[model samples]
Target: MYVVKSPLPDADLKTVADALQGALVDLVDLALVAKQVHWNVVGPRFRSVHLQLDEVVASARTHSDTVAERASALGVSPDGRAATVAASSGISSVPAGWVKDSDAVGALADALGTVITRMRQRIASTAEPDPVSQDIFIAVTADLEKHHWMFQAENA
Candidate 1:
């Protein structure tokens, strides 16, 4: 059943794999939430918020791909399925109906904050086990933080 083998020892591989899988789930759900908000956002700031939501979507999608690929390269299968994401994602759920522009901004900021917290934990967990994976987490966290800052500032 082992096709691609990992260079890491079993213990280290397990640690890195867990971190990567958690990261993948978070990123995938982040994109979905941002897009949902983008579609439903209203109010005077709708145009700007809608466009900003797209930026978060783009970042999440791009990072999700990188995280999945990194997991594969390390011989860990990445599960980005909707079910998996729904079950494992650290992000909170977006509301079901039309979201006011300010509410949308607040929601996204909260979700980004959650994801960034988890990403920092992953970054720490993977540091000694797999520096490469840790590096990816670091970069991802940086990008997510930028989005978080922007969303937070929207309400300021």
Candidate 2:
């Protein structure tokens, strides 16, 4: 689908909003998986990974909520439903029992990093329509990057 209603007279804002929506779906999926990992993780790193997964889930939920709000602020309907997010999310899902004990956390970390990179690119695409939205996207990207790095280190 097109990013905005019409053209918005500026391409940048729409791009930023699109980036936000994309990020929103990803965060929603990541957060849900984090929660699942937290609940189902077993084996050697059980306690540690479980706790870390809880933290990741919390952050993911917040980011998802923020991105949805950002999209709403820009007059775009946020695809906040779980089914919608799951169907459209760019991250590949790890089915139940398909996740390895060692890879659970790392996969989430990788997904976060990937989403952050894409969000930055979209933020650049929106340089003309709205600076405020661009800034918001940047902030979200930075946060996701930090989260990704933290997960990488934690999982290491």
- lDDT at 128 for candidate 1? 95
C-alpha lDDT of residue 7 in model 2: 38
Best by lDDT: 1
Using TM-score as the measure, which candidate wins? 1
Q: Mind giving the per-residue lDDT tens digits that candidate 1 earns over 74-130?
A: 999999999999999989898899999999999999999999999999998998999
How high is the CA lDDT of each candidate model? Answer: 0.96, 0.74
Q: Which 10 successive residues of model 2 have the least lDDT summed?
A: 1-10
lDDT of each residue in 1-156, candidate 2, tens digit only: 544453355455556667777878878887887787677677787787778778777878887788788787667888879788878887766667645557877777777766777777767766667676677777777777777877788666
Off-target runs (Cα >4 Å) in candidate 1 are none
